[model samples]
Target: MRKNRLKLGLFIPPFHPLYENPTLCIERDLQITQFADEIGMSEIWFGEHHSGGYEIIMSPELMVAAAAERTKSIKLGTGVITLPYHNPLMTANRLCQLDHQTRGRLLFGGGPGLLTADAHMLGLDARESRDKLDEGISVISRLLAGEWVTEKTSWYDLNDAHCHLLPYNGPGSLPIGVASAFSPSGGTLAAKYDTAMLCLAATSPDGYDALAGNWKIACDTAEKYGRTMNPAVLRCATDMHIAETRDEAMDQARKGFEVTQRYFANQTAHVANEGMDVTLEDLIERGEAVVGTPDDAVAQIRRLEEKVPDFGTLLLLDKNWATFENKKRSLEMMMRYVLPEINGDNVSRQKSFDWQGEHAEEYFKTFQQAAQRAFEKHAAQTEADK
Candidate 1:
């Protein structure tokens, strides 16, 4: 029963079928962002991908910039910027500019690129990329803080490098989150920097088991680094879709589940490795992918909180594992139903409904009398007008 403000948001890689037009896929993702804003979703995070046709958005910052113009209140974030892919100085400046463009609604997520192919094409090895991630984050953080850094490092050297344009929200308000995908690299960075942690694979059993341990690591790192770690700002993400009924949701999800599964398995092994019997049903059963009714979604989230208490946000992994209509409907149901249930907003409404039902006859008679009076008043008004 650990209670906290459960903010809703989407972590969209903006997946699409290989045969589909890339422009259309990007447009559809933008449309979803606008829709999410209209429905009071607090944030929308876009992923950075280079090689994959399914995850076609190569620049999450660009996508966020476009989404910024379309959305007013919803915060736009880089699902991650893949720090290894860009120059740290340039990243710091670009993100600073984005913070102003977005009117201070930017959450800068730092991570090493997930796809090995993406790194290899850019002439980076795993060791080099991880080192870059570490250095890149450090450099970006310093630049964001308006520090003039001069250093000769492994990858790139900067001579008194500093960002000309600082963040619109001042120095510290724009959040910096680190993405942890079944690894401690992100958690360590988050701790050392005193930033937010995004547990990208928290839905998996291994991920879930490591949740508390990772936070402990973060806490220890924070203590060693003389920084404060706020566990409440940590976000746990999971694949989720909701409908009017569990069977209906599963039916709708079955249409595109395998397509999504294949993409994840092929692209980054985010779902399951090949030749594994991890079906859509298996994911749902394991609390990895929740394709069910709003009630079921609520129950799953409660269970997650039970396992890891006091965690702040539950990020619903946005994907097209159903029809466009079904996907939209699922998000709508999540906002209208699941959110209220988890936040306890539905308790008073349910209580009021029960109270009314207990005195139904009396309430019906009173309503009938009130309607008669209204009708008679309307007739009298008509006569007076005549």
Candidate 2:
């Protein structure tokens, strides 16, 4: 068992098919957020996208603001705001305000834009996105810290600019994270900024293989800056659809997974041309997803722990691969069964039950003796009265 309990969260890239009603889709997302909050999910991160029709959320801040109103405890995050696309000063200001709006429950996450098309539309060279992200993070971090920044970049300029509204927790107190996939850049950036690492591709083959290596990179980079990487803030993101049985889970998730894979095939080279043909079995066998029972979800999380032992959070990638009812069921099952088992939440309960069983004979004997004594005393009193 881990010394620290692992936390569960949701990463909503929100892969809704083009066929679904967009309005209802967003509504369902909020409903999911509310349900997750009610069930005690630690956090939920919304994604930002510009051109991808499938990932429809344009501003994760708006989603966070809307969700903040609907939820009570679950911390909301921009799974990532693509830094290169936004002005750093404006981005920092919005985040600081959201930190207040969410009552300090906001988590800031930034990344290089995911879509080449989004970059192309902005007339940005996709190759330069990472460098721009690096620059944006520096500027945004400073602005959020209430520093008056006078910096100029090829894309944007900041002239003694600072956020009027600092974060609710005060300057340099906001929890920030950087999105990391197969590259070491995320780890390096996270180390440089002392932010959390959101391992967005944790369950994927390449990403899984890179997990330990990436953490090592982060530690090494942090060492260079005389800082230590905190494993408690490291979050691993993966796809999962759990039910009472593997077959049922597969049945629920199959069609939607196929649709999502087809969409991926069109958008990214990560999926092959025949990606749509990939089945739930393939996903499970390849270890890319968990489409099974709560036990299987627990096992998958343990597997990730074995790779990166102290990772803080398991962020379920909200692919909407299962129907809404089944999806909710999956999350409930995780909370009721998987989480307790993994975190040892039931250890004391189980021990108390066993202790009572072990002492049952002695307890029964004492109860019998006390009843006999009471009966004898009552008979003596009756005889004396007679």
Winning candidate number (lDDT): 2
Ten contiguous residues minimizing lDDT sum, candidate 2: 267-276
Sequence-dependent TM-score of model 1: 0.88
Give all TM-scores, in the order shown.
0.88, 0.97
CA-lDDT, candidates in order? 0.84, 0.92
What tens digits encode model 2's per-residue C-alpha lDDT throughout 58-176? 89999999999999999999989999989999999999999999999999999998889898998989899899989998988988888999999888987889999999989988889
The parts of candidate 1 lying over 4 Å away from their true place are 1-3, 226-228, 267-272, 275-277, 348-386
Q: List the residue pairs that clash in candidate 2.
A: none
| Residue 188 in model 2: lDDT | 94
Error of 1 at 199 (Å): 0.8
Instruction: Give each prediction's root-mean-square deviation over alpha carbons.
Output: 4.2, 1.3
What local lDDT score does residue 151 receive in model 1, on the 0 to 100 scale? 83
Residue 264 miss distance in model 2 (angstroms): 0.9
Q: lDDT value for candidate 2?
A: 0.92
